[model samples]
Target: MSESLVQAIASNQPELNVEMLEDIEIEKLGEGNAATTKEKENEKSKKRKTGAPAERIALCKYIILDELPFKAAEKEGFKIFVAEICPMFQISSGYTSGGCKREFSVSPRLTDIVGKSIGELLVDVVTQWLLPRLFSCTLDNAAANDVAMRHVHSKLNARNILATNGQYLHQRCVSHIINLVVEGLEDIGMSVIRGREAVKWINASPSRSRSFKDIAKIAKVDTSKFLCMDVPTRWNLTYLMLEAALPYEPAMRLFQTMNPYFASDLKERNHRKMSIGVPTELDWIEVKRMCGFLEQFYNLTHLVFGSHYFTSHQVLMELCDMIGLITDLEEDEDDGFRNMVMRLRLKLGKYWLEETKLNPKMNKILYIAIMLDPDPRQKMKHVEYCLKLVYGSTWANELLE
Candidate 1:
């Protein structure tokens, strides 16, 4: 906050108690980690005589979209908004008001994702929301808000930071879009069936769905002429393109009939790695699946992302719906914990886009949350992708130009 604002508040309060004013928690501008360094050093100094080797820090990472504006940087005509990720291991200490306030125990790691998503959101708020009223471009630079934003960016850079949602946070970001596509699959009547029982298969034992995939292959051959037509089946983006061309009703029925877990046996299912959010993190396979769902969207065919269902508009509505249904997702635990963590993740995924900064147009249509692989070694892969989209090719280099 600016000093002027602080003074205004202090003067308003007759008592002028500095401590009480200081106690109010401001949103994280990345200061949470300063306290942990001294403690770490003290431990090392004490342990030197006993001389056990110090513990190693294991780094965790994940990949977000390899680019921006869905890939091309400012070619989409937007500014870059960067975020620094700060993870806080915390503690609580008592205070006069009541009990304790939480304090961070370590420093935050920072990374720059400054690109279309952040820029658009900030611009949207400024232009569509604040500019028309709070400030006018016709006027010159205003005060606090812009200044606060710059300071926040500085703090993020001074501290080593992660993108918001950090590594796991990426999972949350893309899942919002994935969940929308999954729900879109449901829209063309994929959730119901006829004959022996469509609804039954859907509600059937997970194994029952396995039998349906087999049935679909048989049906494919038998109805060879009919199956030859394009169908929209976006279990992922490529599948979605194929599914989009088919007759909706049959395409959906085909989808519901497809078993998502065909390759695995029950033992494999049980052993499928996952983390209980409260207990531990997910295993690599589950993590890969999360990345796979997102990566598929940016692959070969999606050069242009906006469309009927795929457009930022439709994709965003589905996300808002997920947020509205948060209670139902929570109730999923009521069934007792088989894939409960995954299910809960699916639920949280719905809200993931809400975290991204988007223009109202994009915001209303799509939420673009992003997570990045923290290992800087992999950073170049994503950066290369962004460069391709931004510069059109490394040689053209308009961003550089």
Candidate 2:
């Protein structure tokens, strides 16, 4: 705060005792005075430790460096590029009657990712664009990223820029890890295959879609919603397909009986083979159950995808909630769901262990974020309790200490 603002505040508080006013004045004057040798040394140490300018120190605390990758299909051959990645930041302006207030902003930086290697490209970006501005980098769990981060640390060490000892420099992307866990679950079982085939067939051609609509009308079922095609890479699309198709189970079954061509088309297009097998009543029930199960994950993903606000601090709590749900579902009466949850639980456990290996500085920053959150006062005691529950007293105590 400026000295003028401090004086104004002190002047407005007439009831302020002489001692309080004197202290405030003294502090303001101290800020205006020249720095002592010891104070200069301490400031330099802090600057080196954080790799941030004194002016930018507060703003860099929660900034994130990420890469948004895209394929350059326009070219003759396949080429991938890290098209753009925006840095997101939040800064508190001043204290209000209610509390402190902050403004959020995003600045996107675009750079060609083609170079000698991915690590070299990343190192160049870090040095030229991020070095002093970035507090940490959030990245997908890929072996390439591990190599890239190691390269970054090596460069930083060579420059004597030991920001958090280059340990807090790497912040694992929770969303990517969760997507992988869900992918693993999908790989193990073809539980959604029947539902996928049913949707794919009905939505394959206009004639088939019209036939399905007519069947829905004849069966006195709702025809407002249509079946949706799902992309293999995004599981959310599959969840959405299942959700949209569940209500049309009766119509679909009747349509399958009425039209034998539902199993195969006379001609195939786009290398898509004819999809066989309509979803049975039992299969529809399973789809509904899987949708219910996946909704939690979908919601959590939406919550953390936010960039304008704090997210890292909530990662642990969300993981805790997910693990708890997985634990409960692992003992489910439905054998299928129980088995799926078992696979998901294993994946979640593996990622959780990897996340726990984050540097102490990164953990400290996340804890500070949680404590500073306006709506929820995540006190240290509560954080410790959660840690203890998840990682046991020994580990939690060590973290707290």
Candidate 3:
């Protein structure tokens, strides 16, 4: 009946076609819902695809800022966490993290890194950034840095941007200066050499390390405190090595007694130098003395390198303590120890003593820092006393003047 009605309508109204009638019937029956569902699906797909890039960028930032290892992203636990929170994000590999590090690294061109070039770059940065005031620049003991600092001092002085005509513009790195002082006593005596060789012999192989651990246990020594080898160039590490080895001295002696091969092996390695064979009673005594001497330097180095504390004000007090330490140790009866202390004293004086021609004149800032300190113990009188103890009263008065 509907078909017949449609035919009658088409015949009565020639403009209206059967196809147009079919479309109107389909819309009424809700067959267009399929197209609407497809559109929603497409919108959801677009959102999912776009979310991944943002999540990846966040992951990259997390890795970079937290200083996490590249493999951290690919770990099973991390991947599972990422999947739970962001299913669309794919975890990257270590290689990808390394690539990101390289891309983000900022460094000056290495082709021309001379003092003049360095000064120019620094001036450019200071000008572009428009810093209100330029103060000191701490640098290690390097000839090139000396030249660069002079150039910077001149530039800032010409602009009238520096106080005191840039006299305190070059601050020597205290840690580096300490290193130089300690390094001056590198070859203290054969006792240190034998002690180092003993440690090296113990840590040469896994078998030897385990044997030492077992011996330490038998000697009732704390096995948790393991022996460590020191880098020759790093005095702090050497101090640590000696400190760690002191507790194991009993174990070391017991092992030496049990295994004569220990001394024999070291002797062979040292080409039969009897002095470098094995640590003796005298060697242990000297080592203990050396450890005590180096402790101050180790502590000062840590204090100087602390990032969360203001160390400038404390440097003068610490330097006074160091000078006193060296002075006290200078009276040791042992010729070798006295010689070592003398060498360190000479080196310290070279850099710190006001009367010495080799002294860098930039240490006035240190005195200034101590004078400004709010500590009751660090008043002007105390500074004067410290200077008098280090330099003579005449030089101290001159410095104050």
The prediction achieving the highest lDDT against the true structure is 3
- Stretches of candidate 1 off by over 4 Å are 1-304, 307-310, 324-326, 332-401
**Best candidate according to TM-score:** 3
Q: After superposition, how far is residue 71 of candidate 3 from its true place, in Å?
A: 32
**Candidate 2: RMSD to truth:** 28.4
Would you estimate the TM-scores of all the predictions? 0.21, 0.58, 0.68
Residue-level lDDT tens digits of model 1 in 1-401: 66787788888986866665566534233355444666775665566424322211111111122211122322213222211121121112122443221221121111122323343454455545433222111111122223333433343333433243121111112333444434343322111111112222232454454554455565563333221111234445323322222222343345533544322222132212521111011222232333333343434124224334333223323433334343344445333322433454554444442233322212211222111334454344443343343224643243223
The CA lDDT at 175 in model 2 is 78
Question: What is the TM-score of candidate 2?
Answer: 0.58
Decide which is better by TM-score, 2 or 3: 3
lDDT of 3 by residue, 82-200 (tens): 76755665665545356643433332333225666777777778789897678788888665576678788888789987777777888999999999889877566777778888998
Residues 312-340, candidate 2, lDDT per residue (tens digit)? 77776776677777877888897867888
- Off by more than 4 A, model 2: 1-123, 126-133, 157-162, 186-191, 217-225, 232-234, 256-276, 334-336, 354-368, 388-399
**In candidate 3, which residue ranges exceed 4 Å CA deviation?**
1-113, 271-275, 356-360
